[model samples]
Target: MIKHHPSETLLAQYCSAQLPASLSVAVSIHVDMCPVCQAKVAQLEAENAKEVFSESQLSSSTVKNSHDTEEVDFGTDLLNLITADPSIDEVYEVEPVTIQVNEHNYELPRALTRISHGRFTQVGKLARSRVAIDDGPLRSSLLHIGAGGEIPEHTHTGFEVTLLLDGEFSDEEGSYVPGDFIWQDGSHQHTPLTKNGCLCFTVVSSALHFNKGLSKLLNPIGNLIY
Candidate 1:
């Protein structure tokens, strides 16, 4: 069961295609694993459709001297625009992509497999590999943390979103299992630990800022690693 979820505002932004690409991907992947969020997104979409239809009807009633070429099908166009992107609602069991780590293979979330290009780069001494996906304003990665691994206590400068894909991990708040969506900002700081290991898809707008201990030394070079 997923204990954490993207807020209703975030889900509404996702439904309206108003979120940035990286954040959008995070929400989409969460929806893939969480039916509750999926249903919420669907309801938002329906409400949007209703608003568009109402506006279209009002516009059509006020139109005068309209030519065939000048007239536009607002409802059709809006519906197409809303539903055209399969990333939001498509079922992706046709072609699954898997990545290997420490002699073990893990299947990536469908939303991630589309943008990862099947590449992972090793980072740190722990069993972790960061698969990069650039999304303009945000930096996205697929992070794999092996058993007993820990991410040093750190805070964020901007915003960070993490979507758990496999296994379990715990932090100051609680333990997060697959499909859990965690959001962090500058004011938050915690060390993430995995007992049985876990794989996560993460999006960060800025490099993580380590708050204490020896990890603070890496602050100067954090951008290179985070």
Candidate 2:
């Protein structure tokens, strides 16, 4: 039972391919695990397709009227070519891929299986593996929290998008399970903790601002470490 989800604006941007690669990947992973989002995305895609088709039809009608003897149906030709392929309806099997973190193995989403990732960097109870994606200022990574792990209270300098991949964690707001999408900005602050360990895919646009205790001192190097 996933409780959190990407906002409607984000979903629309995802369907239009308007999001940055890292954020897009986060939304995609959420959609993979959430049936509710899946249906919404499908509907958005259908609507986009219909709009494009309508424009194409209007263009084709104009072309036919311009050249009276020449009648060309671009949509039909394209559809025929696609349907002519013997493997068009065939489904291919995808090999399962998993990543190990904190001595625990968790399977990755299908969308992430092919993306390259760097070696894990460990810091206390947290481990991070950077996903190899170039999205300007956005950085994406897989973050793992060991059992009883507690992240210091912090706020984002820009924005943070987190998709829980496995296990469970709780913050000041509430508890989050696998497939939960958490979005945070400069206005939000919280300390996250996991009792039995958890794995998450995170995309951050900037460094975090640690708010309390000794962790606050790390602000100088937060951009480099986090």
Candidate 3:
């Protein structure tokens, strides 16, 4: 069987609708592939059935945009704060370096074109997307990680959610195959590269405040066009 995934608690929080859409989708894909993470998600969901959804689970507004970047360190505390039940003793999966081949293929999928094709006039090809919440800027994204693509290492201004519709990926978190979901608070940074080349689905909130200067090169033609 495939190895465990990046984090279990993070994924659990996402499925329970505790994390932001962006990060929630990421963690979700991870859990889909790793049974360990899935189990934790199930447990968390059951608990939430009795308990109210945690507000602290995903604090998107606190991420601090370019204007507030100074006030927020935007480092560490990347992951959201969560309370896991003691009964669920599963361990979080470690991030993976090389993604699994043949895990899935968004590269060849046409249905996904609907999402990938959408671009903002300035944003160009949207590498990220967000859920529309009141005018609060609480956003999320479905990243178009291309085959053999490598997403740069960036820290979160808020939370990040990723879902692997096709292909497999891994980072400091762990390996994620298709159907896998991952959740990350603020403290996550990893460069992901596909092995055999495949497409990946991801959702992220509080757009990653990229520390690296590759933004220009990363987007190039698609920059802000989306």
Candidate 4:
């Protein structure tokens, strides 16, 4: 019963490999958890493949008479590229990785398991683990909110994307469960809180701007903590 999803435009960009690494990873993790999005991505990929095949066929037809040598087989070349590694076995498997926060353990999504993440940095009831992805100003991390934890009301200077990995959380907007993909920009501001606790995968393009009284002082170290 996942309600939030990446926009269709975002999904298209993801299918075409047009998004930045951090955003792409966020969308990928969402697709891993959402069956609806998984099917949509599959359809988009098929359509893209069809278009590429059609263009390749047209190019091959136009060059058929001009070449004296045998025509290169693109499909064979692709197959060779896929199976070029001699050490690759007939089967491959990857074990899931788990993270611990406040004595609670949660398994990471398959997409995240492939990437490297650093140690967690704790600040009161909140903890954040930076994901090692170099995408210029875009920062990615795993944010864990312990029970009764709450983030101060803040607006984004650029953009923020959060994918709920486990548990539930709520804001001025509404409650979000696991697999919810929440996107926010400078126009939106809210304080997020969890009752039972929650773990989220988040990516931020820039530092946050706290709106409340004393919390505004945290604006300087927003990027470090979030």
TM-score of each: 0.83, 0.88, 0.44, 0.89
| Model 1 Cα lDDT, one tens digit per residue, 11-65 | 9999999998888888999999999998998899999978867875845743222
Candidate 2 residue pairs in backbone clash: none
lDDT of 2 by residue, 1-226 (tens): 9999999999999999999999999999999999999999999999988987886674665234355666556677556757889887977687889888867999999988889999999989999999999999899999999999989999999999989999999999999999999999999999999999999999999999999999989999988965
Q: How close is candidate 1 to the true structure, as a TM-score?
A: 0.83
Q: Each candidate's lDDT (Cα)? A: 0.81, 0.91, 0.49, 0.90
What does candidate 4's lDDT look like per residue over 1-226, in tens digits? 8999999999999999999999999999999999999999999999998987775674574323245665645665545645898766566577888877779999999888878999888989999999999999999999999999999999999999999999999999999989999999999999999999999999998899999999999988877755
In the order shown, what is each candidate's alpha-carbon RMSD?
4.2, 3.5, 16.2, 3.2
**Once superposed on the true structure, which residue ranges of model 4 sit more than 4 Å away at CA?**
55-70, 75-91, 223-226
Residue 5 lDDT in model 1? 97
Across 86-160, the per-residue lDDT of candidate 3 in tens digits comes to 544665544433222233323422322223233212233224433233224444334554455676676665655
Candidate 1, lDDT over the whole model: 0.81
Which candidate number has the best lDDT? 2
- Among all windows of 10 consecutive residues in model 1, the one with the lowest summed lDDT is 61-70
113 in model 4: Cα distance from truth in Å?
Answer: 1.3
Q: What is the overall TM-score of model 4 with all chains considered together?
A: 0.89
lDDT of 2: 0.91
User: Against the correct fold, how does model 3 do in TM-score?
Assistant: 0.44
